[model samples]
Target: MSDPTFSVRPLDEDTWPAFAQLVEANNGVWGGCWCMGFHVRLKGRTAAQNRAEKQERVREGRTHASLVLDGDQCLGWCQFGSPAELPEVKSRRLYEKGLTKLPEWRITCFFTGKGLRRRGVADAALGGALTEIAREGGGLVEGYPEETDDRAVSGSFLHTGPMAAFENHGFTRTRPISPHRWVVTRTVSPT
Candidate 1:
């Protein structure tokens, strides 16, 4: 169960400060990624560049996320966006090979704050994302999560989230995109 003390908010101009604080405190989240890995390639970009680009996207309403908050502080986030909004997904070749049609929304990654792991932050964020999606007139939502039943995986590498997290939100396993990563999906009705 998610922590009841946590509240969810959409990542927008009003909530960018909290989100930026969390990312900044966590060293730009995954070595200065700033949670932009799923949105665009970060090979030549510096951390500052990534931060600027992410902020620009948010300002332009091109980025989407559910920011999990404890009071005014952001604890984590679940990023979801349309295909055009976030096109750089992991295992793209394999995912494309099996793609019959594009989903309306894709949950690309999650970020939990320092000293706050394994405490249901991810679950809360995922739930929040679903609710936000519904408000946007929901449809097919997809997530790429790793199956962790057979092995121990580090939280850092589970940016897409665990399969159990998706299952908890009523998502069903669709197919495997990698050895441990599977494409999971669910349909959320508009709220």
Candidate 2:
């Protein structure tokens, strides 16, 4: 069950500080990713570069995310944006081979704070993303999530999130992109 005290908010200029706090607390997330992997390739950029770019995007309103908060402290986030905003994804070769059309929105990554795993932060963030998408004139939303049915995958590698979580949010598996990763999609109606 989800905690009633958890609340959701959009990642904008107002919430940038909270988002930064969570990422900084996690060692810039995945060794300095700063959750910018889907937005742009890191290549040779440092953690500080990633941080600056991410903050710039936020200020320009170019990024989108649903931040899960616990009393003003952001616990995690679900990153979502238009295909143009988030062009990078895992399993690009396989995903593109089967891709007929692009989804209006793509849910690329999810992050939960330390010691808060399995406590519904990801679910709350997912739910929040869907709600925000709906409010922004919903359309087809896509996600690449891992299937962890029979294996022991580390939480560190499950950045794309688990298949079960997307399933719980009404997303259906459209096709398999890799052995453990599948492309899940759902059409959220506009609110």
User: What's the TM-score of every candidate structure?
Assistant: 0.98, 0.98
Candidate 2, residues 19-78: lDDT per residue as tens digits?
Answer: 999999999999999989999988998999999999999999999999999899999999
The pairs that clash in candidate 2 are none
Clashing pairs in 1: none
Off by over 4 Å in 2: none
After superposition, the stretches of candidate 1 with alpha carbons farther than 4 Å from their true spots are none
Alpha-carbon RMSD, each predicted model: 0.8, 0.8
lDDT of each: 0.94, 0.94
Error of 2 at 150 (Å): 3.2
Worst 10 residues of 1 by lDDT: 148-157
Of candidate 2, the 10-residue stretch with the lowest lDDT total is 155-164
